[model samples]
Target: MKKHLIAITLILLLIAGGVIFYLAQGDKAKLAAGADTGKEPVFTAPRSELIPTINVAEVKVWTAGEKPVAAKGLALARFADGLAHPRSMLVLPNGDILVAETNSPPRPSGGLVDRVMNYLMNKAGAGVPSANRITLLRDADGDGRAEVKTPFLTGLNSPYGMALVDGTLYVANTDALMAFPYKEGETRITAKGRKILNLPANAPNMHWTKSLTAGPTGLLYVGVGSNSNIAEDGLEGEANRAAVLEVNPRTGDYRIYASGLRNPVGLAFEPKSGALWGVVNERDMLGSDLVPDYLTRIEFGGFYGWPWNYWGGYEDRRVQPQRPEVREYTKRPDYALGNHVAPLGLAFADKVKIGGAFANGAFVGLHGSWNRKPAAGYKVVFVPFAANGEVSKAKPVDVLTGFLDADGHARGRPVDVAGDAKGALLVSDDVGGVIWRVTGGK
Candidate 1:
């Protein structure tokens, strides 16, 4: 009788294994939407899955003398290496660079599903402890490498975005926005930062990158993401989430600048039109090609829809207690960046010293995706714009490639991009722990 029971258990285990393997086949993307930018991205109907397609790239750090592939007439070199998970960057007037090396804070109550996702995150090289500090990198000689590496500011929360206005250096930590007095050419900041305002950050901060950009008019713009994907945590958890906030640095007053962005990551102002723009990572689990991440010129009092709708007025049926009235006012994005590309960095090339196509466009650093089959976006791309600061109807050009090898292992993952004092493109790679510099070809 015992032998019969063991035989039954083995049969059941084999059946379950076969079922999982069949589901793992998942859905394959039909189009290379991530390569196409501007208006009119091809969208497909949502195909929900019982288990999300898990195809995360294995993390393999660069061995030595290995680097990414640059575009034609461009070259790539290591700016600074051997750093912790570098997420964002800021270039000072005196030619020094500040890199925020951080990751998500701990969420002890993330529940069972969250714990499972955390295990996957660890496998993807993003499970390291948050450093909670900013480091300074100086390429004073302009040889495309930083020689002086020092801790600029120490002891902070999970910091992401950074900016310098007047004589104050402002940092957007996960829970609050803080500022410190600054002087040119200083290697370290000894003063304690004054909290300008508290941000919407509790545990289970699913989207914790608080991107910061300074407006020309003494205001700071911050990008905050929704707490849960499609409001699974209820509407009460989304007070200031999924919106951009404008804050007056002098007076500490703040208000919602724009609403309904699912996960706005990179923030920038188009140099010609002076319009504020952002790169948002849209919701996932809607198949490999359902929702496209986007780039848009953010407007005051705008709603792009969250749990209620997506991509203009396409309602997501999975969201419960849906509000149909909100669909009437859902604003469409200016451009679609394709599905699951996970665009994390946005920088304008108006003043970049580098010539050719990169001189007058937007450079986006796609951090790559784990949810999509036959993975997309593990490199940096450039999108051209017209003189009027409007995006052209051209496909995105690959500026940096080779982050993934033939077997889909990630050597590095780009998180944020910026321009250095010399107008060269700077990319922060969080996984490989290096900052890459791109310049005109030799």
Candidate 2:
């Protein structure tokens, strides 16, 4: 009789699991990637799932001669290879390129969900330890390939963003803003760096990449992401998180430039207006297509709703202790880059050599998706801009692709995009461990 009871219980559990799996796959995206873009993204009724869709592309190393496909009139080449998880890049005035070869810091505890996600990251090849160094690549002959490679800076704590203003070089680490004295054409920096200011990086630093950009106003803008998805760990846990910080280079003092940005990874300034802009990664678990990541011209003392709302005024019902009043003032983003694209890099075409439609626009490195079926954003795309530096209404055009093969495996994952002095575009592929250069077609 005991054996019979055990068998019945097991059968019931199996049936329940089957039903859950079916529900998870029931809601497919009703709109295409283009439809869910622009100033107004198509937002469906939030379908909360007990288990979020898990569709990460398996990581595969790029075999010899394998390269990402550049768009028409452009050519792709391996600028520098065999790097360790390069996440960001900076082009020096003297033509040296600095690559931040790093990854996330140790994750903090968040319960069973965190453990499962960590396991998935391990399987996806993102679980490797952080390299924690910046390397320099130089193409002395302007042949579009880096021949001289050297370790530029070492002993970093999962650095992501880099900028050089005047004679000082700034690096945004996972926990703090650090600065080093820099000289033009120098291959490496052995001098110790000083911590300018502490960032919001407590345990469970889920959104770990802290991107930095130097503004013409002498302020350094740091993009710090939220600690949890929609403050699942409680609102009290989100102090000074989910916001852009403006730091004074001289004194290390800082203030919140803007708030309610979930994960503003790429910080940049619009060329014509000089307005600060960012590409933000929104929250998840609200179906695959509900919340779209966006590119926006950031406003000082502005709020782009996060835990309480999204895309201006759509309340997320999931966040507890709702602030309905705050939704009244939530600022809408400038443009949507589709949902779950995980946009990690943004750069404007100041003096673009890659002509045609991409001559004067923004280059976005979409880090790809892991939550949506038939995944999105495994490439770099160009958003055209008018002469005044305002993004045009045109849809995004592919600049670099083929990161995922026909078998749906990721040969490379693009993290950051930048333009070198020669006007060629540079991309950092962390998973495949390479730096790809894109030049204009002959």
Candidate 3:
């Protein structure tokens, strides 16, 4: 009886081995067949090569009559001659360009100090300067001529974000958000400035500039960056510094949409997925130690591990003492931009030009880096993404470079990107005080 049982077990084992061999052979045959049929690999992304899909664009180098237009890391346009330190820009429905000039108040100085009070010297000093208000200008034919130029709105502390909603212009000021009735292409702006939300903003801590974007959901999203590179809340201030606030246009109701952003400058929702996204400028003075600049989806109430952790599992010793507690729980960013590259403006390709390679892509205007000893990033990068909103397969291509010299000096810096009525990509440069348009190789 024992011999019979052993014989039966051997037979069963042989049968199992035969079945395993058969399955392996089948898999091999399928793989060979797939190779022959030119099918994509099963494990890899379906679309691996993320090429740009940009429409035909017209490039216009700014020129002040015979003299070339010039400035630095600024967004500017020829709205009107003699515009002072214009740094931000917006387009009205009627073809008017709103230029936000960041003018510093003249400091009271003694005569002896005034003579040595070189305006250039104060600028050379530190501390980010304040950009006060928006100046409206019009050029009917895009012909480098300002038909009208005037103050659309005034008395703003520091206006950074501008959006036109239902014939009303919403301005995101540093300390508060305000809006006024605005007609596109209107030569002058007379305001009955309505208060939208009063935020305790414009602190000297971590994040200062409050960027705003109107999402497809018809709600306004505001991004406020963190106060410090990696420090915990300052003494008595546990303010909502690094958060994205959602505001309703119809009812003026506002609340925190997302949290834990360092300094998000540009915000836009993916047209196809309705997913919120932003171009964030990471913190400075960490010796390239912590988080990289990132372009990621803004999930509600998500903490990006500011000052404590960064990227994926990288410990930031400067932000907190309990590194072990925060290390594993901290979430990493979707895409890791190179260190110290100050990414600023973002614009998703629109319907007019979103047909081909640009269908699911976005453009970023890097304001460039100053803290990086060598100072990198003075270009506009084109990041192409998959249709499902995943960033892994996205490619960061240099849509525009040539701004920095080989020896590490800045030639130009991009401020913002917009798709004009004709489906062309227009980039505004504050440093050169000009608007440059870019077109695909086609």
Please provide TM-scores, in order, for all candidate models, with all chains considered together: 0.93, 0.93, 0.72
Clashing pairs in 1: none
Between candidates 2 and 3, the TM-score winner: 2
- For 292-318, candidate 1 gives per-residue lDDT tens digits of 888888998999988789888999998
Off by over 4 Å in 3: 1-83, 103-131, 142-149, 232-235, 249-252, 323-329, 351-359, 392-394, 440-442
Query: What lDDT does model 1 reach?
Result: 0.87
Instruction: Give lDDT tens digits, candidate 3, residues 358-379.
Output: 5567877877654443344567
lDDT by residue (1-442, candidate 2, tens digit) is 9999768755655564455446567656777658877765677888887777767789888997999999998988999999999889998888899999999997643444454566668757798899899999999998889999899999999998898998999999999999999999889999999999988788778888999999997889999999989998797878888999999989988999999999999888888889898999998988877789989989999999988999988998988988999988999888999988899999988845788778787899999988887788899998877788787788888999999999999999999999988888999999999999898878
What lDDT is reached at residue 80 by model 2?
A: 95
Candidate 3: RMSD to truth: 21.3
Clash pairs for candidate 2: 108-204
